[model samples]
Target: MTITEELINKINVCTKCSLHKGRTHAVPGEGSYNAEIMFIGEGPGRDEDLQGKPFVGASGKLLTELIKSIGLSRDDVFIANVVKCRPPENRDPLPEEIAACWPYLDQQVRIIKPLLIVTLGKHSMGRFLPGLKISDVHGQPKRAKGIFNERQVYLPLYHPAVALYDPRKKDILFEDFKKIPLILKQIKKSKNDIQ
Candidate 1:
């Protein structure tokens, strides 16, 4: 089996953290292994934990709309979370939980080698570009070293769930979503220039 597949299997059986104890299924994430873009979120919620899939809840539907607005489908990009298993009560994942689960995410990044990683919230953004205020950097694309490979591009955006809770953020989210195509274009141009 490929390394990604193997890692998924390992994640399925992982008990490295207590989060696994309450999980119905460990959402190891899913999407095209060859995708050029990846979307990472914080962790699973009610629907996601039950379904064992990332972004399958109400927030996921909004996320799908955002992806569609960017002229891409879920199949065209990978979707994952910082923690594979859902935290109890959908609370934020603890530092220890993140530490335990990050290796699998790192491996996925190495295997997929995506040119761009879109962090869906502050938690996911912390993995790559920690300490920066999401308000200061949302919609801004930055070049950064990959978790396990060469330099890659990163974008931080508010989680789609934000719209559900606060309608004021919806327009802001859409504006950020619109920047994605432009960001991809620039990345493409830079790659061509380097060649």
Candidate 2:
């Protein structure tokens, strides 16, 4: 099996964290193995905990609309959480939790080798855009080297859940998503220019 598949299989049966004991399932993530882009979120919610899938709650609906705005679907890109298992009461993933589950996320990223990574929340955002506050830098893109031996753009987008709680962010989010198509094109153009 491919590395991603093996990682998924292990995630499916993971019991490393205490979350596994209470979870209905481990939301490993889903989408094309060859996806050009990947979406990373915080962790499972009540809906996701029951469904064993990422982004299936109200926030998920917003996520779908955002994805559609940029001419993609959940099937076209991979989606995973920084933490595969849900924290009790949907609390923010703690530092220890994040530290523990990063291996899974790291392996997934290596396996997917996405041209860009769209971080959907602060937890996921901090992974790539360290030392930055989500409110201050959401939607701004940064680059990291050695992502599969190539630089990859990490776009920190507000989590859909943000829109769910605060309606004011919706317009800005739509505006931000407009950048996806352009960013992907630029990535290809830059690659060719280097050649």
Candidate 3:
């Protein structure tokens, strides 16, 4: 089996935390194995849990549009969550839950080796950049050591769900998303220069 397939199989049967007991299915993530970009989110919500897919609800629609705006499709980038299963009543994942699922996410990053990781909420961002507010860092690219590499690049953004509550964040999300391609170009240029 492919490595991703193996990972998914493990996730499917995972009972590492309480979150699994209530989940309809484990969202192991989806998209190109060779993608340059990977999107990490907090966890699966109602729609996503039911469908066993990440970002398939209203927020997902906006995320889809944002990806399209950058001239890429769902097939072009990887999407996964910090927690593979949905928390009870869509509550925040507990610390133990995140810790239990950390190995899986770490394996994914090691496998995909994405040039950029776009964290789509505070929970996901907190894993990489602790002690920072999303408001201060959204749309900005920060380079640091990640689960897989020392030079991983990350871009923090508000969860698309935020726009559902306040429409203003939608415009900001779009603007922030616009920086992706440019940041990717710069990363590639630097890599080439190093070689």
Candidate 4:
């Protein structure tokens, strides 16, 4: 099997943490294996857990629209989560749960080597850029060391779910989404310049 497939298989049967016990299916993420951009979210919700897909609910619909706004489709980017399984009652994943699933996500990053990782919420953002408030940093891109790669680029954004509760956040998210193409272009240019 291909490496990505192997990883997914491992995730599917994972019992590294308590979160596994309640899952209907593990969401190992989806989309292009060779994508330039990877969107990482907090974790699976009820719909995602049942469907075994990332971002397939209402928030997912918004995420889809955001991706389209950038002139790309779900097929063009990778979508994954901090934890493969759903947290109980859609609660935030505990630190221990996140720790248990870290290896899988780390492996994914190494395999995809995406040029940019877009963190879709605080949990995903905290994993990379810890202690930073999403409100203070959303839409700004920063280069930092990731679990596997040095100089990884990350853009933090409020979780799409937030917009559902607050209409003002929806406007902010759209504005932030607009920065993606420019960020990608800048990352590509910088890489070429270095080469």
Candidate 5:
């Protein structure tokens, strides 16, 4: 079995945090095993809690459109949240919750070894790019060193949910989404030139 599968199994039975006590189902994440891009969001929301899948709410629909704009689909990339369970009323996940859930995300990064990790929200941006403000830094791709052996690229982005409530943010997100295709192309071309 792949590392992702192993990690999924472990996450399915995770009880490291108090959030697990209220969870109806664990969102272990899902996507292509060979996906080059991985999207990491903050946590499951209400719709997610009901369906036991990550990003199933209206935000997810917007996310789908964003991915489609970049000439990709959900099936083309992997998706997961920083926290697998829903926090109460969509409140910010506590530091302890992040602590309890971090190892799983760490393990995921190792397993997939994605070419790029796109953080969708401030919290996820915190883990990858500490002390970075979402307003100033969204859409900026920084090469994060020493996370996994592969030296993955990290791109902090505003979450789709933020755009849902604000129309102008949606336009900004679309503009940022346009960058994905070019970025992926650069990575692909670089690899070919290297070889």
Candidate 6:
């Protein structure tokens, strides 16, 4: 089996962290194995936990809309979470849980080698661009060295969940979504120029 498939199989039965105890299903993430873009989120929510999929709830709906705005579908990019399992009551994942699960995320990045990584929330952003305020950096592209591969481009976007709680951020999120195509083009041009 492919490394990604093996990793998912392991994750399916993972109990390294206590979060696994409460999980209905481990969302190991899904998308093209050779996608150019990847979207990473914090963790699974209610619908996601129940369905063993990422971004399958209200936030997922908004995420789909945002992806569509950029002329892409859910299948166009890889989508995963920092933590594979849902936290109790949908609370923020504890640092230990994040620590336990990050290697899997790192492996996903290594295998996919996406040209652009769109961090869908602050937690996901912290993985690549640490200590920067998401408020200041939302939609900003940062050159980040990959955990298991070479340097790559990272873009931090507000999690779609934010709009659900506070609709004011929707415009900011939409504006950020609009910037993705241009950003990908620039990355492609730079890569071709180097080659």
Using lDDT as the yardstick, the better of models 2 and 4 is 4
Per-residue lDDT of model 2, residues 1-195, tens digit only: 977778888998988877887789899999987898999999999999999999999999999899998888889999999999999999998888888888898888888889889999887887777788988877767776535765678888888898887878887788888988878887877754211
Please name the candidate that would achieve the greatest lDDT relative to the true structure.
Answer: 4
Runs in model 2 lying further than 4 Å from the true structure: 191-195
Model 4: runs farther than 4 Å from truth? Answer: 191-195
User: What local lDDT does model 5 show for residue 170?
Assistant: 95
Cα RMSD of all models vs. native, in order, equals 2.3, 2.5, 2.3, 2.2, 2.8, 2.4
lDDT of 4 by residue, 1-195 (tens): 988889999999999999999999999999998999999999999999999999999999999999999899999999999999999999999999999999999999889889999999999999999999999999889888876678788999999999989999999999999998888998988863311
Cα lDDT tens digits for candidate 3, 1-195:
988899999999999898989999999999998999999999999999999999999999999999999999999999999999999888888999999999999999999999999999999999998888999989989887777777788999999999888878999999999999989998988753211
Query: Taking the tens digit of each residue's C-alpha lDDT, what string does model 6 give over 42-161?
Result: 999999999999999999999989889988899989999999999999999999999999889988888998988999888889878889899998988888677754567889989999
Alpha-carbon runs more than 4 Å astray in model 1: 148-150, 191-195
Residue 109, candidate 2: Cα error in Å is 0.8
TM-score of candidate 2 relative to the true fold:
0.93
lDDT of 5 at 73: 87
Q: Rank candidates by lDDT, best first.
A: 4, 3, 6, 1, 2, 5
Q: Each candidate's lDDT (Cα)? A: 0.89, 0.85, 0.92, 0.93, 0.85, 0.90
- Report the lDDT tens digits of candidate 5 across residue range 3-36: 6677878887889998988888889777876789
Cα error, residue 186 of model 1, in Å, equals 1.0
Please give the distance, in angstroms, between residue 45's alpha carbon in candidate 3 and its true position after superposition. 0.7
Score candidate 4 by TM-score against the native. 0.96
Taking all chains together, each candidate's TM-score versus the true structure is 0.94, 0.93, 0.96, 0.96, 0.92, 0.95
| Model 3 segments more than 4 A misplaced | 191-195
Comparing 1 and 4 on lDDT, the stronger one:
4
